[model samples]
Target: MASFVMKQMVGGKLNEMKGGLDSLTGGNEGEGEKTETGEDPEVVAARLEQEERRKDKHRKMEQEREKMRQGIRDKYNIQKKDESGGMGGFDMADGRIGAARKKTPEELAAEMHAEDDSLVGQLGLTEHVEKAKTAVNGAFEMVKGFLPFGK
Candidate 1:
């Protein structure tokens, strides 16, 4: 039956594995002829090639990372300075740490509102439209105030 054929196949595979082990261990298991005591020349050469390839791959990766960092620095117009200096080098124009002055809260809010207004303008919503919406809401509140059960 199929079971008998499967068992035969498994036994053949086990014998092959045992023979390979015997050859690798200088035939101490008596399943194959003995090999030389010295290391296999082919295996040693393969290991040396693998080690050289790994070192080359790591060197390439480091080079690529440094290139990416340099590109980012160039794109942002950043200047590199020595870290041993007492005062860190900063781009004052870009507000990088050593800027002349900081903005007040009101200035910051104004800047945010300008950004919002620009976004609204981009979305086709004009300032007059916003004013009309406010007026409509105010009229609705005034009407509700006249009704006793408005609350």
Candidate 2:
């Protein structure tokens, strides 16, 4: 009878060990942590600030893109022709905005690559525009000097 009791206790101990090993090896990521959703206030505040900073940066980027697009439109003399344009947003144009045809994926991708700098809101464009204008104007002046008979 004593031997039988000892055998039962040994078997129970072995079962508990097996169960513990199984849990340690293969289980959900946060299986037994206390209060998984609970976070410190400081951590939450920091996270929020980080998110706001990210959003602000994104907004600034979006604004820069708008400025570049506007610059291009002004360069090409596009204007707002219609008061209403239903669903597709703005009835505006950089110049008589053409038909609303969408570009294929490949075409769009190519266009995007060309406009990469504009999207990133780079500062080099202002210098580029100024230099180009000066060069062209200087060339015109030189040509005018050569054409003394006309002026």
lDDT of 1 by residue, 18-134 (tens): 999888887764434333745566667788999999999999999999899889999999876666552443335564566545577997989867766576767867676779999
Count of backbone clashes, every candidate in sequence: 0, 2
Best by TM-score: 2
The parts of candidate 1 lying over 4 Å away from their true place are 1-38, 81-151
Candidate 2 lDDT tens digits, 19-101:
88878988454445434467655667888999999999999999999899789889999974544653364233433464454
What TM-score goes with each of the models?
A: 0.31, 0.32
Number of residue pairs clashing in candidate 2, backbone atoms closer than 3 angstroms, sequence gap of 3 or more or interchain: 2
Q: Please give the range of 10 consecutive residues that has the lowest summed lDDT in model 2.
A: 86-95
Which TM-score value belongs to model 1? 0.31
Among these predictions, the greatest lDDT belongs to 1
How many backbone clashes are present in model 1? 0
